[model samples]
Target: MSRNQRWDFVRNKNLCYCCLEEHTVRSCRSKRDALLHSYQATEEAGNATTGSRRPPAVLFHGGESSKALFRYIKVQLYGRNCYINTFALVDEGAACTLIEKDLADELGLDGPEKELCLRWTGEISQTEPASKLVNLQISAANQGATRYDLKGVRTVAHLDLPIQSLGEKLIKSRSDLKSIPMPTYRNAKARLIIGLDNIKTRENAIVGVPLEGRELEGDDFVAVRCRLGWSAYGRQCSGEASRPRILHVCECNNGDRLHDLDEAMRNHFALESLGVTVANKPLRSKEDERAACIMEAKTTFDPEAKRWQTGLLWRYDKMILPNSYPMALGRLRCLEAKMAKDPALSQFLMESMKSYQEKGYTRQLVREEIVSNSNSWYLPIFTVTNPNKKKTRMVWDAAAEVNGLSLNHALLKGPDILVSLMGVLIRFR
Candidate 1:
């Protein structure tokens, strides 16, 4: 950010706190000085941090670089840890914005320690700004005049097979990368993976909540992480101290309510004020995550399409909705979810809160598509390994230190894959 930009944002001191502009009431030097009878603007801004909220983990997937996203969020949180993974690109586009719309989209060095240049930064939405900047590109691509545009969410190949048919298509080892039969993509696109691990998240925690054989067995549902420390930075911000953080204050669901989420995210997170088109059975979360190498999330929503869409996005902080409701309303709902954490996700033990309001929890299954050398590979959640096959690392937690069970081909392909996996679980902190 430039020195002038900081001054401009600081000049307007009555804007919304979430806006993260220099134009907040607390940002005005005169007003700030008058209120506190002191002049510690830099120090004050320096000490600010995002309140207790876990913003979604951002993974930048574009043909360009971004900076505005980080700078804006930094000012928003004052000073908090928001984990971000930036993927540098030679081409410039805004594919990443769809997922990281809450962040900025700039690519360059602001030169030296001038973090104040974020004078008028705003939460970027492709629905507006630079006009045909995205439209023309998309139009051209569709017409074959151009090569790529962030529009027209990429085409996904979804194929459903009988459980037995899927069982026979398994491929073993990295060397078997080419042996797997896979579909193809004409170009890149926005993607996410939806996996139904017998897991649950209560109070932003991940745990195991299995089922005998059903969709989302009973009451368990996935919850967005509300608080997390920034592990590393994809790039550096000027005059930076500690890495930045984010706080999400969104709303989510208890189980598979696919239809509800679809409606909510329609015109909500879409471009040109247009509504989001629903795509069912688009492969699986694991496949999309591995094949696309972009931002991905996993959740379990109802299969009825029009009925319920409560899958990966359940328990999200819906604070950014049109109305200006107290952040607490959303918080309280998530609080209810927290009380319902599963054992695999939450290290914090609480036996009384097993089922969410006695609804019980059910497990969701997702297929994974892996990629190596620009090709695709398939693996079901409960993959049966061949004894002669090598090993694949399997973890129950996000933290890498947690020792997890490995896939032993012989036994996995022999008797029961899921049952054998249960015995290999390693306790972790």
Candidate 2:
């Protein structure tokens, strides 16, 4: 029908803007179904594999602080993406709400038309009244729900799918560091997301070398996470606001610090665990490697030489567990297979990896084994060997694993899921 052929003034939205009703277009329930189906197809078609977290779920383990990190990330990646749900573990007097609004906010996520926080604290004595703040936010939330004209993807959920800066100085300037390489998809059409999932050591505290206000005694469960994203994306993709296709993720113990010193330090720890040694000798001054660590190669700082020094390292003792952190270095390599257009970045990433290698580094891959007969679950392991360190070991257990899931998932669902006392780290662009 023509605009002038409108039988009614409001135009039959039920009939669609093209003048085709749901019945006319197809016997589907609504256009949403069609849209959702389209997205599912787009994702599946774009991806050739979906078996091993083709896009690994970057899991974290922490308390409220986890929420803060997720929120920071969400605000940066809202629209055109969806942050999945979270589940919190109980402790102290808190019920451990698995989901939260802080995270929802970054993505303009307002869970449920009406919701309430677990009763623990009293209402604040604000002049405007909390009730009004809640209502206004809810209103804005509703508008955001249908704001984006999503295309080239899937359908809608009951709710619209929801979904950082860094440090200064002591850090190397962009010019100081080498560039990471990226492959060009000159022929590849449709947008592809390069995602990174991060997870920390402790859910309520920092994972790396311990700091203030943490309950983890080193005897209890420490945290471990599996983040997924492209290294190129790690440096790109601020959010939908920024016209970037790469998706960067930093999953750790505390808040999301695009550039947090403490978190960055741990991130280094992760890199080091992979066998990237900054110093010639092992870090005997620091904590021992956990039973399930994977060390990569080894490297050290030689400012005097003004060049990256590289060598490989492996575990020396069976008692010492090597360290390992997964890097899309694997994906970056594949990307290199076709295109090496971004030589600057490719070189930079390799330098960092080389520094990590100085200590004794290697790629971390998932290895599955049957620990029990029931087949209830198979152990997922990553192995690393650094000559300077001890022998290699496997990384797996219930506490760290479950905690990683709960903490990271919570990040996807809250503003400040849990308040953490861990030291923060920042990643520079």
Q: Which candidate is the best by lDDT?
A: 2
Q: What would the per-residue lDDT of candidate 1 be over residues 1-429, giving only the tens digit for each residue?
A: 454555466556544333444465455444223322224664465456544545457864444322212111000111023322222111111221122222222211011111111011133211222211111011111122212222211111211111111112222212222232321222222221111210122232321121121112232211111111111112222222332333121112223357766777675655543664545634445433342332223223665543333222212222122221233345445545654664432323223233422444433334453223211111212112246775322222212111231212111121121434543563111
Off by over 4 Å in 1: 1-130, 133-240, 247-429
User: Each model's TM-score, in the order given?
Assistant: 0.12, 0.14
The model with the greatest TM-score is 2
Tens digit of per-residue lDDT, candidate 2, span 225-330? 2121111112211222322221121112223333577777888768756953445544332112421132223445678657665432222322222111222234
For all candidates in order, the CA lDDT equals 0.26, 0.29
Ten contiguous residues with the weakest lDDT in model 1: 70-79
